[model samples]
Target chain A: MPDLLPENTPFAIARYTPDELKAALRKMYLIRKFEEGAEESYTRGLIHGTMHLSIGQEASAVGACMALGDADKITSTHRGHGHCVAKGADVSRMFAEFFGKESGYCRGRGGSMHIADVEKGNLGANGIVGGGLPIAVGAALSAKRLGTGAVTVCFFGDGANNEGAFHEALNMAAIWKLPVVFVCENNKYGMSTSTERSTAVRRIATRADAYAMPGVTVDGNDFSAVSEAMDAAVARARAGEGPSLVESMTYRWRGHSKSDRNRYRSKEEIADWMARDPITRMADMLVEHGIATREEIAGLEAGADREIAEAIEFAKTGENPKVAEVTRDVYTEAVQ
Target chain B: MNMDAGTLARPEQETRELSYAEAIREAMDIALAADERVVLMGEDIGVYGGAFQVTGDLVHKYGTDRVIDTPISELGGAGVAVGAAMTGLRPIFEFQFSDFATLAMEQIVNQAAKVRYMLGGAVSVPVVMRMPAGSGTGAAAQHSQSLEAWFAHVPGLKVVQPSTPEDAKGLLLAALEDPDPVLIFEHKLLYKMKGEVPAGHYLTPIGKAAIRRKGTDLTIVATSIMVHKALEAAQTLAGEGIEAEVVDLRTIRPIDRETVLGSVRKTSRLLCVYEGVKTLGIGAEISAMVAESDAFDYLDAPIVRLGGAECPIPYNPDLERAAVPQVPDILQAARALAGERV
Candidate 1:
């Protein structure tokens, strides 16, 4: 499995098969490539509404999600393509969604930010800062009450950490010992202000001390490290130890969205993070470890390309919702 | 959606009295005991016995699963309740206060209220969000607001406000059976006033208004705390040979226009009172209804509206009282309308 657990780190890697590692790597690459494609399409006006790409922080989303069982629920942020893909949501429907088609998750009413599939336990991508926090907590509450043991993972940005709901939810989760994990993809900026300038807490995880839960800071750039941390968090939650927070130190390779001029950060800073690119690093490790050949990796890349193209095509032929569809699913109505 | 006025006046209590708080507790106990699906979730509901103590000993009696306590996040608690309701389980959520409901409005108004219509009738959000609404506890502006009018503006929501203990239990039980999202705004002051309430499963159909007292001198339509104020005003006016019939519009949305209009026609004088602000309040709608109805021909006086003053609910006790109509405000307004005080 590409020596996923270095002789250095403290977490589980014993059960991971080589194939599982390759598959997870492939999925991360696919999400990155698809999102980049979508961003490009957005500039060309092929996609409508806002696009919050998870290009720079793919590892955090991927690693945490990989640790999740299919039955586990995930609440995602506005930049949720990674969460959706990792949860096994249909890529075709997602693409159709960005294309504003009725065949999409929310029938095009929600567009990119509001896409959701409850069956997959992907509880919508929220537009509000820290908005998805409570929903994930709710899902976790539901799981705990129903005795499902299904964990609920909430993905949010460092920005959400400052919101009142963040503290409120964290406190409650800790008090009740709900099965939830709070993942902060600390890509350093809340829109424009850097996390350092905005937050007083040195480490976001340190704030977990207040909640009496294990607080962690993981190498979010390294998929193995992230996966390890997430595995532990998810395990603790499933065991009913209560909620935990993992502050993933990562950077968004892209601007917050497709419209950035990159002014908030310098080119050198970007170049430094680029050196630790998650996809490239994982790919190189796969070959060095002989887990997969260069050609096999090439084939995987080729497959991702074809899949993304087919998704675009699927979206192109799809239709927007019948105007009446807008009023559906927000609440359930009896059809008697 | 309209209740028969004759049916709603089925005697508040033939034998006893109950406080508004006790009435709600009775309702909660009845609901929790009667149906397996009915559960309450909110902050302080468990070990603390609820923030307002409405759920006294519920957690001890029912255990943590049914009378679940939540974190201080209203949005999360409300969202969980909504999610549970979407599944087969029915959930009743308690807001520590009505003012804090704004934090969860995205879930309550956008998600809970509209889920039914948004899903094209595929799902039903039979969630009941109960908030202790209006001012009385000296909680100030942040803690008090009568927002029934806002939910009333929404199409799918069924808004219920009960002034008496009997209606409190009946309406809540009825709200549980309803297929759509129903908001029951229990007033802060009515929690202690006692009255005879039937035991066991019963219902007060949503979207129906109740006529508390009958008179021909004037028709006083009111809600929540204002309903009691209107009744008191009616009694004082009765001694002065100015009879004021009191109508409690229990359900704000889908209001019982027939009951309201019938009294307006008989009295030929209409006065609407609400705990909400005067500007764009429920009184406006009731006044508009009277204006649009055939009862306009029976009007002997211009329709009068009495509501909270156009200002934030002040923190100072006296100022807060001045902001919203008090019992004395109702009496003075009724006397003016009846041409008795002047």
Candidate 2:
């Protein structure tokens, strides 16, 4: 694919070292390859149910998660594989969950849309639009009340801005000065409706003004821009400066889901976004900055491919849950 | 044994008389005082003392931080409570009226009820939602509603309706101690009824039924305000030479199947009464439980359920009174079920 931006356009440098950049690149590549493998599995009937993929929005997920501490929390959207991988979820277990295996994160119950890793401070991925916003606020409240010094990052889409939950959670977070960062991935369309058609505000970030919080918009495809914005938001939250809205202007390279026809947008629009692929942009940046050679970047892709292949194999070999134990874990006996 | 009875006296334990609303407030007070992670959130709860003053003086005692006054956003507050519970805090969320719960069903039903099971028990939402329910204040259709059946129908939720001050305190304490989401429906009419409540830190074990009055002719299973009415009807039935048993169903979801079945086996007749609408209500579940259980063989007559009318609770006093079952309705139903009159 041809590079979309002009040469010598000043590629913003990410603050991470060469080794850390490689790790981030590997994570982004893993997310992309995992989604591709999931799509293939769906076609083969190995993975049941539909999934929302974040093909071109990998930079926002990795960049934002990189700015958070290990103890920090995040609530992700339906298109959450990128966030999960970026936040250090095991690929094998994630695949097992998607394949509905008993050894999965949710023990084969939560499939893709509901995978959660509580020990890693990931509350869970929600199927409802704007569902995670208030949950993030609650986590922030817990952090504040317990004095955990941890912040929560809430990841959502442009469509979620229209939900009443978005407004309510934002207002609550602002009033209490809860330690949370609202990350909106403006991927152009919510399902099939474009942002311009559905959202009243021109920019989703600007809605933060009504809630009395600072709002920032950045080039979501640029890792440096997303990272810098996220860093500022996280710092503000950790310092108890309340919540901030960070809108990442991004796009999805694939259709909304497997059932979607490419009738909403033109093929040219898809090609344009594909050309500005986040992984490719990072690779070019690494090469230009003399951080890594083309061969080293190629090696990262090979590593990611091998890892995803292993994960798929593990998912295929995993056991199915027994029918007799279906009713277990509905409620914890801890407080009973 | 008769001679030693006067000499062998026990020390008197401290007891106090409190209203149902005060007992609920005391339960929260004890919980908040006992646990630092316990917090209260609702509209007008802090300075306004809650919509019904059930949370009176709690804001003063716990300060505004623990007794939080949230904006009038049921969906947002409930979602926040669920999120907080998932994290660490044991938040008690109050809905001003049970009717307002319809606005917050997404958070309560989808998130709170399904999160633990969906996540394979990776997390537990120990959130308590207290809703003042039922009619009698002339609040009409919007404010007056008995929505305990709605939450009871959900699997991961524990639904309880406290009819007396003591159960109100004990059940709320137990709900706070519960690991999953618990919905407590406090009948609005019973909020002022006085009763003797035990002092400090007690739990009325959830999922158990209390046999208020025992008899041989018939069994009356009732919940919330109907429990009081059932007891009254039982007293009147005794004067007419028909003995009736009254069982107070404290928790709705767990259903106290053993207690209900045991009662039916002894009486051979069952009458389910509740304040909610009759069709597909809690009574329906109880009736179905009896019909499916081994107690079905002991039934001498058809099981009857006396519930609220199909219409909305009207603003007029007479219509509202006619909407739900009263003492006279219970007596009449018991009389006919006991084969005393047609």
Candidate 3:
């Protein structure tokens, strides 16, 4: 039995309504279900090439996104399905992207990774690991220059934390005092190698001191904790206090890519992580707090299941682009 | 020692000649003073007065912010320039040499070229990338290649390779004002060739080719420092009864195809000269265009291609001259193609 409540604790979990907690849980479950469907589809050859699934990192994505306003943006990584879902990318179009359909956001030009909608405040998902950092810097610069209050959140994995681009972008952001949040989803491992082995430091956030920015570590499995950390970062950026780095200590349940066989971890490690499942944790919290019953949660899950099935059906019917599109969008050709 | 020494000293043709480096400095001064948005950026560009002294005293005059000395990241600089262009700034990014462009190919080709279109034409990138190109300075294999042909292949890119001080000033101005990304290739050798450039704000259009000399025997198309060599060769060809017209294809991408074809129609013979290698060089593109057009039958001789040898641009001066077409080589190629000399 988990301890119900401790008298003296580190920091109190900020007050979240039962419905809000339930919504976060639903969002995490939606991301999980969507990614699982994508993984199975790729295995069955319905999807082409490679797909990066954010199966276990859903809480960090959902909670952080929930902290942002509609105008604030979130730049994604190659493992971007969770971020896309959390940022409200159209399910059918995202599905169509994997389906290699003309109706896709980039017309099948940018498959799973590069779905972008500036209007939705979701700067396109990047194929390069640390590529989003500079773009987010640019967006933050624009926001600062234009005097718009919008802030940008750049999301990347632990592997990208070592890239030169990451350091360069953060330095620029720090100097300019740009309104941005640098989120490092440290899922213990980068592809197959553990972050502890790859990174020289214990925590990814510790490196933020080099750039003169505030750094924080959060339990990414807990939605409220992630939300609290993100809220502070976002508020600091919006207040023009420069960028902050949030190291979300999370885990990925699946292998790196759809082709990964998961030979890196033991069964005990997998079960221990499963015991800390984000969606089930939030649901359990909601029920224990008298927020909602199990029947309502079950119905919401069923609704998401139906909607996702329909989205997949609609995406499968989408057509691939004409072969001649290869020449298009390379540049603004007709213009001088 | 002349009968009228003052009159001799005041010849109309003796206009003030300036080096290409001086001309570029003057252009930067004029552009920065004219437009508040124009800023110069590169490694060692500011207080260092630029790597080749092209931006002499610019940082002192314009301050450190306007004359930015960037860190040693080509990708970061180019990427920042793209973002800056999207904003209100008109950035003039300097590649230390043409060789470093490969490091920032994605930013140059993908982001800078595609941003406006990717955003449904919501923005424009008025970015200028000035690169020092070509061999003869003995900068070695990595830094001595002429890569104008590479950027010219991109659609949204404008390429300018100025032969003289006048064109360097005019083209730099035009590139700053143009709404697209323009690449200016300043040849390593031409930086010291003095010629009178018009004072104040001047511009040469991005698409027009300049006809250096008018004649009727053969149309010699050249670029960069080769333009001057072709002019000298044309004068030599005139002595051999081969009146060669010189056409400087200044802009390679929006290549002055019309000017070359029109000149070929009048001259009846054509020769393409460049410093890059002969295999699949810009010469081949010129040859194919001539052959595919109505001008093919008008050839007095097979279209002569006086290009650099198909080898790395060697550091040896004699080998370098032999590699690319020089004045004597151009003279020989012109006269022979005109059926006047073997």
Q: Per-residue alpha-carbon lDDT of model 3 for B1-342, expressed as tens digits?
A: 001111012223333568889988888998889887788878788878887889889999988767877777787677767766755578898998888988888778876776554433445678899999898887667888888887777767888898878778879988988887899999988887777766677677777788888889889899988888888887777777877788888888777778888988998888999987777878888899899998777776788888778788787787866767788888777767887432
Q: Rank the candidates by lDDT, best first.
A: 2, 1, 3
Candidate 2 local lDDT, A143-166, one digit each (tens): 999999999999999989999999
For all the predictions, what are the DockQ values?
0.24, 0.64, 0.20
Of the two candidates 1 and 3, the one with more favorable TM-score, higher being better, is 1
Interface RMSD (Å) of candidate 2: 2.1
RMSD of candidate 1 to the truth, in angstroms, is 4.4
lDDT values, one for every candidate: 0.80, 0.90, 0.79
Candidate 2 vs 3: which has more DockQ: 2
- Deviation of model 2 at B67, angstroms: 0.4
The estimated TM-scores of all candidates read: 0.86, 0.96, 0.83
How much of the real interface does each model capture, measured as fnat? 0.32, 0.79, 0.11
- Ranking the candidates on DockQ from highest down gives 2, 1, 3
Residue A86 of model 2 has an lDDT of 90
Model 2: lDDT of residue B308: 91
Of the native A-B interface contacts, what share survives in model 1? 0.32
Which candidate has the top score in DockQ? Answer: 2
